[model samples]
Target: MVDTNRITGAAKDIGGKIQGAVGDLTGSKHDSVEGRLREAGGQAENLYGQAKDTVRHAADEAYHYAEDFYEQGGHSLRRGTREVSRQVAEYPLASLVVAGLVGFGLGLLVNASRD
Candidate 1:
């Protein structure tokens, strides 16, 4: 996952430095300016690549964290369901009473909403 832009930018920066040095030795302002411009462009490209890499890494981390959280949530739900089932089986009459109460409460809520 080496970024091409980063590599290209580094090469351009090196070339620009050499060009600038030659321009200085030959007393050519045009060459010097061109070299400076190239150097700046290379720096911008390198920064862009670095930013892209940072964002991608952050997104990958967030995705993995969310995936782990979801898996844990699922496991917790399954365990809770199993516990409830076992409790209901161990106390059938109590479970029936609780179910009746819940139904009655839901019916009350529905009637209140209608009113």
Candidate 2:
């Protein structure tokens, strides 16, 4: 994305240079000083635009990274669920026993916490 401030700042800088040159030709110190100040302001605006672009780019990269990470995580979770489903279908009795054991363990943990 192009920054408008950068373009505006560049135009301002060019205008300042021309103004300063004209001031010099006419021997006007005040106009020359004003032109230099305008140039400095333009440079500052350009720098601000650059900084904003850098931050925006960084944010975009981070958002893409997070999006990719979440997509991968979701894929892994789906794969894991499918694997567990296949395993339970292959060994229903074993799966039931494992579930019972897990429930009993959780109950024990809960009771212990109450004490």
Candidate 3:
């Protein structure tokens, strides 16, 4: 996942350094200043590339985490449904009573909210 910008930026930075060195040895102020500017630009590009890589990595991790969560939630919901079905089948009368009570409680809550 290494970015091309990082590679090119590093190469450019190295070239700038060499240029600056040569300019200094030859006593050319213009070349030296220009080399410094190029070096700065290269460093900036490298930093930008690094930032992009960090963001991409985070996005990938988040996607995988969400996918795993969805799968686990689906499995748990299916398991819960099976358990509830078994319990209701085993105690039909009790299940009916409980369902009625829940409905009544919900109705009461709704009526109270309206008031």
Candidate 4:
């Protein structure tokens, strides 16, 4: 989306240029200086709008990237869960032994932490 500031600034810059040109032709130093100052201000405003646009675009890209990463991670986790379930179903005894060992190891870790 184009920033409103950019459009207004461009219009202001054009008006300033016209004013300055007219001032020069009519020999009005005050008008010339004021016009030039206005032009400079317009240019600054335009730059600010451009900066805002750049930052917004960058943020949008980052958000999309994170969303994609999260979706991919979820799929991987589901696949891993299915694979583990299949393995356990195919070897119930081995799975049971492994689960008991894991529980025992966790108990030791918890005791160590308490100490």
Tens-place lDDT digits, model 3, residues 1-115: 9887888888778878888888899999988888887888888888988998999999999999999999999999999999999999999999999999999999999999999
Per-residue alpha-carbon lDDT of candidate 4 for residues 1-115, written as tens digits (9 for 90 to 100): 9898888888888878888888899999988888898888888888988999999999999999999999999999999999999999999999999999999999999999999
Give TM-scores for every candidate, taking all chains together and pairing residue i with residue i: 0.91, 0.87, 0.92, 0.94
Task: State which candidate has the highest lDDT.
Answer: 4
TM-score of 1: 0.91
The models' CA-based lDDT, in order, is 0.89, 0.89, 0.91, 0.91
At residue 13, give the lDDT of candidate 1.
84
Per residue, candidate 2 scores C-alpha lDDT tens digits across 24-114 of 9999998888888888888888888888889999999999999999999999999999999999999999999999999999999999999
Worst 10 residues of 2 by lDDT: 2-11
Tell me the spans in candidate 1 whose CA falls farther than 4 Å from its real position: none
Top candidate, metric TM-score:
4
Candidate 2: the clashing residue pairs are none
Which candidate would rank higher by TM-score, 2 or 3? 3
**Tens-digit lDDT string for candidate 1 (11-69):** 88888888888888899998988888888888888888888888888999999999999
Q: What's the true lDDT of residue 114 in model 2?
A: 100
Q: Model 2 off-target regions past 4 Å?
A: none
